[model samples]
Target: MIENRKYIVILAFLLIGMVYAAKLFMLQVVDDTYKRRADNNAVKRVMEYPYRGVIYDRNGAKLVYNEPVYDIMVTPREVHLDDTLAFCRLMHLTKEEVITKLAEAKDYSYRKPSAFLKQVSGADFARIQDQLIEFPGFEVVPRTVRGYPHKSFANALGYIGEISPSQLEKMGKDQYSAGDYIGISGLEYQYERFLRGKRGVKYIMVDRHGINKGAFKDGKYDTTAVKGENLVCTIDLNLQQYGERLMNGKIGSIVAIEPATGEILSLVSGPSYDPNILRGREFGKNFSVLQKDSLVPLFNRGIQAMYPPGSTFKLIEALIALQEGVIHPETHIACNRAIINCHGPHSFPDLRSAITNSCNPYFVNTFKRIINQEVNPNTFIDSRIGLTKWREYQLRFGLGRQLGLDIPNEKGGFIPSPEYYDRYYGEGHWKHSTIYSLGIGQGEILVTPLQMANLAATIANRGYYVTPHLIKSIGESGQPLLEYQQKNFVGVEARHFETVVEGMADVVDHGTGQYRAKIPGLQVCGKTGTVQNPHGEDHSGFIAFAPKDNPKIAVAVYVENAGQGARAAASIASLVIEKYMLGEIKRKNIEDYALKGKFVY
Candidate 1:
């Protein structure tokens, strides 16, 4: 019995040894999947960031650039908060501050790592770098934050911000992470891909204490991130700055463009917020403050705010009427107290005189003749071809639809139609007289300030103008606005526009805005508009371009509640033109009159 027991024990020992050997084979040779995963779990990857591209104006002046900032990252699961007091001292905060910050991070997401503090200055980062070792889970990481050296073009340059949940859904999984910066508005948002760099990943080995050891396997599969492409805009920095200064403390917008190329010279929306406010993680709080303001500095009035084009649209109506053979340029209409209730009575005075005077009755009478087949041979319903042709003309001039510009906040202003009339007052129920005020650029017709600027630009270019674009160039891309270089014909022959141009010339020569916008040596042409605002007084607007022969620049300005279009808006426009063309204000007395003296309502 003793001999049998000894043999059984020996057999049990052999069985145990065999099982151990089999397990070893599986771990070392047959299966390495779990061991590989275990090693990977300890590997904490670190990203080496790339520099963002720069922005320059048309004259090669830098507009936007990057500045390095430090972010305090924390892994809550691994937080060794033992020396909380020391950590707070290093980071320029009190013990309670650290605790509150951590609590906020925890509330955001305990599962995902969150930033405890961000936008730490270089000095602040240096103060805490040595002492950061005291905290197990905290580390300083380098990130790029927007630095607007000029702090001028807030609504134009746009701002970079942390991606939101809704934006993430739009970006999809592989494209973006929560902390990644993306353009929120302006040119940045419009060309996000070109401005946003390609993302890269890094492999890192970590220790048991959750500390980074080194690069994993010498970075065999690592990729280097590519920096974003730079953009050189067509904006003339001098004009843009001057325009901003003149429009300060007003509730209005202005847009200026080069007539030949459709390159935007300047675009300003008043009540603007400083782009510097969106620099770092405090963006959430800063944005909240801007959003709550009554003036709404966040709003881009240039392209986003649609207002009645007012008398400015009369040119479009006249062009449409003449192009469709509705009325002769010599067609006559009598104006009286009963007709349009203008400041005074007048005769047809030819198309030139009517345009110069902005005769409401002439337009109202001419508008009815437009839909009359006896005159145009194209009633609103009968031929349909002529009406469609007129609509196409408006679209070509970028009046009825979007202009496909680089700015992200652009809106398509309204343009009425026969079908639209059917919806509003029913089929054929609304006659030409019902919407007759449209001829005077009133009623349902609406346009953005950008569009009105575009109108001035198109007319200045003679027959056609390129679509307005913001950016001028990128790295390999020679120019950012090349796509908008084609001439958009507005159905008016080059020669056919002569009469209108002459009429506009007469306007600055003798019309309401003449006192402010006239230039002695230059043939400046302009139109004034008084767009009715929701508030008490209507908005004053003036659009013009100078030296009519070789038109260098076209500008439009608006002054909110400034009474007549000639009052403040024309004065501002006149000053900008003088500054650009002359490079110096020839008349200091006139400028002082504008600057020191107030406008009489």
Candidate 2:
């Protein structure tokens, strides 16, 4: 029995030894999990960032391109530096900054690579490339920063910056890291997905001191980074630069659109900085200066700043009245100053003449009839019902709501609803008498310059408009977005726009806007508004479209504290039309006046 027990113990011991040997073989050779872990110790995974897409103007002119930059990446665990002070001097960084950055990298991950210094210019990086070898764990990686050759379209193009921790959390660690640059606003933010190309990775072989030897395994596990898709913008580069020059000293915006296509020709928000200022190492300092400026150059007034539409809104009133059969082309209303203040030189103006003359009482009465059509017996209820219907028409014109411009931070200008009035007054407590100022484009009706330009485009298209867009095409396909191709009809008949168009033409020919808005050889149609301002001088505003037969450009210009619309805004719009239509400005005197921002008739 003792001999049998000894043999059983020996057999059991042999079986255990065989199991142990098999497990070791599986871990070391068959299953690559442990082998990969060991390989990670000597291999460094470097991220290869793809270049962001280039931006071109409608005429195929390069607007924005990429400039090569370098980022110094560090692996905390692999760092072997004896003279930290020498390293700081070579990198143009303070010793304290180096210590802080190294500590931050260590806290993030001792073994992982993090950006130690970013956005070093190609010229600067060239000077330090050879010296970088002295610092063991630090290596240079190629990256790109946006380069604006034109240095225009600061607000529309936007700027890029390091992604915030909050953004990183939502984007997920697999897609973005802490130091990744991202589009912050404007078209850059709107088209980031198409602009930010796929990132590739390369497994690099490293020595004991973390100095890169070469590609691991002859670059077998490497990926090639794909470049981002290019963008073809609808902006006319010449027109944009010209508009920027015209609006140099002004504190307003000019938005011009091609009426037929709704393509934004030029969008200028004044007090804008050069797009270059927001790039490179000085970005942080320059951005802080812009933010603190009192004029608020960073605020995109073209689509974000809302202002009272002023008298330019009268065209919509006439259309809505004509649509509802509340007024006809010859319908006459006396210029009754008792009803509302009157300024234009006309009396007992008909519907067409009222628009040409901008007679306040005529529009006030016209809006009254449109709103209080006796839809309800009670005046309060009738006003609410009328406002609801009026607001619907206004909304169809792309007012009181966001136009879905392909840029971030677009504010929808207010078109007061019955509910809005209810909050201000009380439900059913207001009537056309209380809200009559809205009839003249005042009181709570506000619009962005983009909306006003779109409004002009809508009228030029005979009551329909394409949604304005900055991008004409994306990638090599050269196709605009589907939304921009479709027409958004403003619930008004095409015929109603004929009389309004004729009146606008007449206004440019012999009315308030005649002096500044009349462009020779071009049938420029326009309306002028001297918006009342309690704070200071009235805002000057004008909306126009040229060549009454086949209109090309529709523009809206608003110059704050610039008195009458016929002064600065009208002059600017007419100059823009002449420049676009004639390809030159013969009226250099008017251009000079606008450039100087002198609000004189």
Candidate 3:
């Protein structure tokens, strides 16, 4: 019996040895994962980031360029710091920060590298690189940070920051890792595909102490990093700078576009911060401060702030009335205060005179005839049908919808359709009277300043407008984008625009816009609006184009709480045009009034 038990024990021991041997073979020979992990200890993989594209103005002025920066990466398992205080001092970090970062890195991955410190300036990197060897497990990765030479175009130019976890996942692990910087807004985000170049990789061989021995396998697997494509933007640097200067200390936006090409000349969002404030270690802090600002300096008001188009929209109303055959250019309407309020002295005004005087009652009466054309016996049903047609025409004018501006965060301003009223006031319950303010470009009719600028461009073109774009060309191609080259006709006849053009010309020459919109030696055409605001004072608004025959520049300016349209908005628009066309502003009084916020109600 004892001999039999001994044999069983020996058999059991043999089975255990065989199981152990099989497991060892599977790990060492059959599976490559452990082999790769072992190789990772000695072979370091470094990502070679590409230089982001340079942004230039139309006339070849550098707006955004790159400056050298460094990112400090650490592998928790490899980190061996004997003098923690010395290392912290050299890296400009506290001992607690060092420990916390190491612990966090370990939580992420023991062997994988993670960013310990980000966006160290070139000067600071140069100072710290020599002493980096004193601390193990840490490596420096060279990178570039955007530098704004002019310190202008913050909201339009956009900014970059470390990618969030969600963005990283969407970009995919093959394309982006955890700590990659991505464009967050504006032109940066719009042109990210062209701006962010391809990333390369280098397999570096290192010794036991993490010292670089040489390139792994004689650089056979290493790839050369390709520089990003450069972009020539449509912005005129001089014009943009001058506009920004005029818009400073104000709470509004200015958008100017070349009527001939649809290329944006200048886009200024007031109370903007310098682009430099968003680049470096202080980014998070500065961003928080800007986000909390009461005026919202970070908001791009040009393409985002939706405001009532005010009387400037009267021009469109006249054109629609003309096209619908409800009202002619010579159609006269009495200034009936019972229908709507008007500040002008003109009692019975024609279409041109109504627009020139910004007679609200005329437009309201015109809208009434257009909406209540007796198409249907029921008032609500007729209003619904009329509003649908009206909305269609307004969309052709690029109102109440996104104009597809290249930048991000462009808001499609609301144009109340019959459906919208149905949703708000229930279906068939509302009529033209409920939405009458839309006639004077008030009530639910809203338009972004960008749309207003595009409206001026459309008027300047006599019937059509190209899609406004910031990038003139991409990757050294001097030609404008094909999409921006095609003119979008607003379904209005060219001859109809002539009557509105004359009215607009009179607006700058001798009407409501005369005080500030008139530019001497240049036949300026414009319309002004005192947009109503229940919160505070009325918003000043103006849209204009210069040299009535062949327009060069089209501009729209909106100033919040600035009272009459002839005040801040008209002055700013006129100044922008003078600087762009005449190469300098000779109207110091207009410039000073806009800059000093001197708007008298």
Per-model lDDT: 0.78, 0.90, 0.90
Model 3 misplacement above 4 A = 1-42, 209-211, 425-428, 478-481
Over 519-538, each residue of candidate 3 has an lDDT whose tens digit, in order, gives 88999999998899999999
Error of 2 at 469 (Å): 0.8
Against the true structure, candidate 3 has what lDDT? 0.90
- Which sections of candidate 2 miss by over 4 Å? 1-41, 209-212
Q: In terms of TM-score, which candidate is stronger, 2 or 3?
A: 2
Model 2 global lDDT (CA atoms, 0 to 1)? 0.90
Candidate 3: the clashing residue pairs are none
Q: What lDDT does candidate 3 reach at residue 440?
A: 95
Task: Give RMSD (Å) of candidate 1 vs. truth.
Answer: 4.8
Error of 3 at 509 (Å): 0.7
Cα lDDT tens digits, model 2, 1-601, are 9999999999999999999999999988899986865654477788889999999999999998999999989889879879988898998889889899999999989988888888888899989998888788888889899999988999999989989999999878887777788899888889998888889999998765456778989999999888889999999999999999988978899999999999999999987989999988899999999999999999999988888988999999999999999999989998999988898577899988888889999999999999999988999999988889999999999998988788888889999888888999988688999999998999988899999999999999998999999999999986987998999999999999999999999999998898888988889989988787879999999999988878999999998888988889999999989989999999878887878876765
The TM-score values for the models, in the order shown, are 0.88, 0.93, 0.91
* Backbone clashes in model 2, listed as residue pairs: none
User: What lDDT does candidate 1 reach at residue 589?
Assistant: 58
Q: With candidate 3 superimposed using the best TM-score fit, by how many Å does residue 433's alpha carbon deviate from the native?
A: 3.4
Candidates ranked, most accurate by TM-score first: 2, 3, 1
